[model samples]
Target: MLRVTDQTMTLAAQRALGARQARLAAAQATASSGTRITRPSDDPVGTGEALRVRARLAAGAQYQRNIDDGTAWLNTLDSALGSATGLLRQVRDAAIQGGNGSLNQDGRNALATQIDSLRRDLLATANTQYMGRSVFAGTSDAASAFTDGTPPTFNGTQGGTVQRRIGPDQTVRVDADGGAAFGTGPGSVFAVLDSIAADLRSGADPTSRLTALDAGMSAVAAARSDVGGRLSELARAGQATADAATSLEARRSGIEDMDLGKAVLDLQLQQTAYQAALAVTAKVLQPSLTDFLR
Candidate 1:
């Protein structure tokens, strides 16, 4: 049988009261701070989960920013190509009119001058830039996609790709192919227009030049289509990233955030329990003779 001594009773009461005090303090801290886990010991697993969710949220935010930049780049490409398309179409129309026998040499020369002006406009369009970076330069650091000369040479990298990471595994090209869009070197739209203008001034048939003009138009249209497709992809990626961020935020809140109603109820319950415990300990550990002498 165990000894029924006052010393043993005192120790038991102290241990019980200490435990009650700890519970009351923990509940008060939770209620005041509005957090479920005050320290790692309170909930280690939940802390780890919250950290992972936060990391995911950060990554999603970055992806969204990339999507935005990519969208802008693609839009710039589309606008430049649209302008080029309009200019090329105008040249095509003028060339058709100039090819007729009824048109006089002076009239043809006038049309040639108009085409030369449009060729300069097209050259400017080919060098379109976004954020000081050439949209048709294919990741190159060149100031312009094409050089300013009699026959503009493409300064852009042929195979280099300007990529934007829109997701953990997804990337999209945001630059246009300069060579494919406006033709590089001698076959360039600028050079082709120069040839047509020369023939018009000499009173020779301008009919042969229309084929090259149509090819230039086709190239610009194709580049614009590609840019539009990339913009659509970026739009979808942005939406997906936003949704993922939202979901991760919710998950993080679930793990770290407290329910005020439940916290308050728990605090009240602990307060009641601790007070009752103090009363019990007081009665059980009544003062001994030594206490009266002091």
Candidate 2:
């Protein structure tokens, strides 16, 4: 036969009541918040995975922003190049007109002045700035890229490229060295323009010097093409990074978020079981003194 004591019965009833209250509170919290896991310990592995995915998404978003900033900087330089190319063409035309014997000394002088003005414009273009920093200054953003004194100095450092990470393990370099775009030594755009200006002032034959001007023109066009290609590459990389970030965010949501429907159902079942346990425990705890004495 099984034996029961008053002390044991009271303890059992108290445990059952405490369990029922805990279940009720859990059910209320789930119903109000619609979440199964409120803390890290609720699902440690899932939470960790979610955090990792979120971090990747944030990194990708920042990479896209970097690409935008880089593109804007490059576009500013490209616009200046366009203006320089147009001025060079004008100077070439003036030189051709001045070369003709039909034009007098005064006309030649006027052409020389125009060439000087165009040279100044080209120099201005080379010194173009973006947000107080010279775009063509290479790694020297604080100094002027071009100075008009003497042989015309480029006060910046050597050509440098910048890289941005746009994916989990992928990075893209989106900058071109100023020297690569503008050339070095005698083949540089500035050097050619200087030669043309000097020749125009000294009464050189425009028809003979026309070949040099054409080469300079080609170099400018090539630089423009190079910038365009880089722009396209940046655009493609930015789009890919954005897509990747979106995918990661969705994956994170799946891992971190709770299924409201399933959580609610489970809470309801737990509440019912807890209430039944409380009722049975209360009945078992109620005992008569006469029954105990017998």
| Number of the predicted model whose TM-score against the real structure is largest | 1
Write down the lDDT of every candidate, Cα atoms only. Answer: 0.87, 0.73
Clashing pairs in 2: none
The prediction achieving the highest lDDT against the true structure is: 1
Q: Judge candidate 1 against the unseen true structure and give its global Cα lDDT, from 0 to 1.
A: 0.87
Question: What is the Cα-based TM-score of model 2?
Answer: 0.79
**CA displacement after TM-score superposition, residue 151 of candidate 1 (Å):** 1.0
Candidate 1 Cα errors over 4 Å, as ranges: 1-25, 101-103, 274-294
Residues 1-294, model 2: lDDT tens digits: 889877888888788778877877877776778655567887898878777887888788788888888788768867977887798788778867877777776777777777777778877787888778777766675566767754567666774655556555766554445555555567666666666566666777656667767877777778778778877877888888878877897787677656788778878888888878878776667667875676
Stretches of candidate 2 off by over 4 Å are 5-10, 23-36, 168-171, 183-187, 198-203, 267-294
Q: What TM-score should be assigned to candidate 1?
A: 0.84
Over 1-294, each residue of candidate 1 has an lDDT whose tens digit, in order, gives 977877787788889889989999998898999888778888999988887898888888888888889888998898999999899888888877888877888899999999999988998888889989998989789889999887887899879999999888899999989999999777888888888888889988877988887888888888899888889899888888888888888888888878999999999999998899899889678777887576
- Model 2 RMSD in angstroms: 3.8
